[model samples]
Target: MNDIAPQVARRVLLLDGAMGTMIQSHHLDEEAYRWQGITAEGSSEILNLTRPEVIAQIHRSYLEAGADIIETNTFCANRINLLEYGLEDHVDIINRRACRIAREEARDRAYVAGVMGPTNHALSLASKLEDPAFRRFDFNDFHASYLEQALLLIEGGVDLFLIETVFDTLVAKSAIIAALDAMERLSVHVPIMVSVTFSDASRRTLSGQSLASFIETMAPFPLFSLGLNCSTGPEEMIDLIQEMSETSPF
Candidate 1:
């Protein structure tokens, strides 16, 4: 769990691809996405509970394909996003089960990366600082939701955390804070990887922060690795990554 970047860099460390995208390839409909009492849009995280064998199969595919790190299917398992599906009560169930499945699949051969993605309620904008007129989930809100997921993932046996697809630095901060707190409570420390998404060709986050600003904003955290994902193809990312490599301390 410690110095994971060095460990990963030691060999051909392969990370599993998109959980949502792979799930969609199954062609599962709303019925496969339903909760006991809630009507729904589509939520990929629910598959861990509703169709666990499928999730295990996904993890097995990556591991069998020689993956070094397998991310749990808990991308939208946080409380804020569960509210959108009216399954806020099932956050613990979703995340815990997802981690357990990944852990069981990975066994001793690979690492299980506890996945945390941005919520529908952006703590940056929803709890607007410059504009108090807008408010919902603030920094505290993000902290609680993230801490809940982190604790469960750790409990379910994960080696590290992957706070991926973060569009706002504050949102990532909240997850980092929660991770620190969760580790303190559990009396165990694990590595954390932070990845962000860009809006377009601007090389800036959707929150309007430049790549440098984003790096500066996240500089204080004890991250295992900080990089980009979900936007800007490999051609553009290579250049951006070179700049970040020269600039980033974590």
Candidate 2:
């Protein structure tokens, strides 16, 4: 999988469009998939739980749409997110199923990007300081959770790790470190890509760091690629990508 990336580098890679938008198109009434456990019976987000075949069909649709990279339908597969709806136990099952569905559909033509989103726990200074139990916000806890998810994704045969919609730099850093640790433990060397979400008012991440700072912080890591995702829209993202490209060292 790592070798395939270089061969495809000559051409621009096309990632599938928004997953939320696609999910919403199906008319599910759930607030979000994080808590609803798309696989849970009778849950509005049951497409992930009950209608995974439908989800895999969606991946096939994207592939037919000319996407070079197809992300798994497991953005909220981590324990932190699943814990919201008491579905934490299904974390491994959900992530594994997502990768399996994607791999089955993608076969050998497209790349399977294991999708991960931000933690459900807020990372704002105010939130942390207010919670007495917050202590120091242990990176180890974050690392263990992400490592669990990454190992499942890798075991399911994902081609790469796609950490997207990150707002907190600390959490994002922890996730990257967790991914690295997981690779070392599993003895697998797959590429990773990290992206952040931004607010409309400010171009910076939720933590107030500019994209340049985020890129610089992650520069030491062996990232196959990096960019922004799930903020504003394509028009705004295009501007951000252009700005990032001009300033980015890579």
Q: Which candidate comes out best when scored by lDDT?
A: 1
lDDT of each candidate versus the true structure: 0.85, 0.76
Off by over 4 Å in 2: 29-46, 128-137
lDDT by residue for model 2 over 193-240, one digit each (tens)?
Answer: 888888784788777888888888878888877788877878888878
Model 1, span 1-250: residue lDDT tens: 4235567778757788878778878888777777686666588888887789888988888888888899999888888888888888998889888988887888778888999899876755645568766868778988999999999988888889999998988889999999989999999988999998887888888878888999998888888888888877878788788889899997
Residue 111's C-alpha lDDT in candidate 1?
88
lDDT of 1: 0.85
What are the TM-scores, per candidate, against the unseen true structure? 0.93, 0.87
Write down the TM-score for model 2. Answer: 0.87
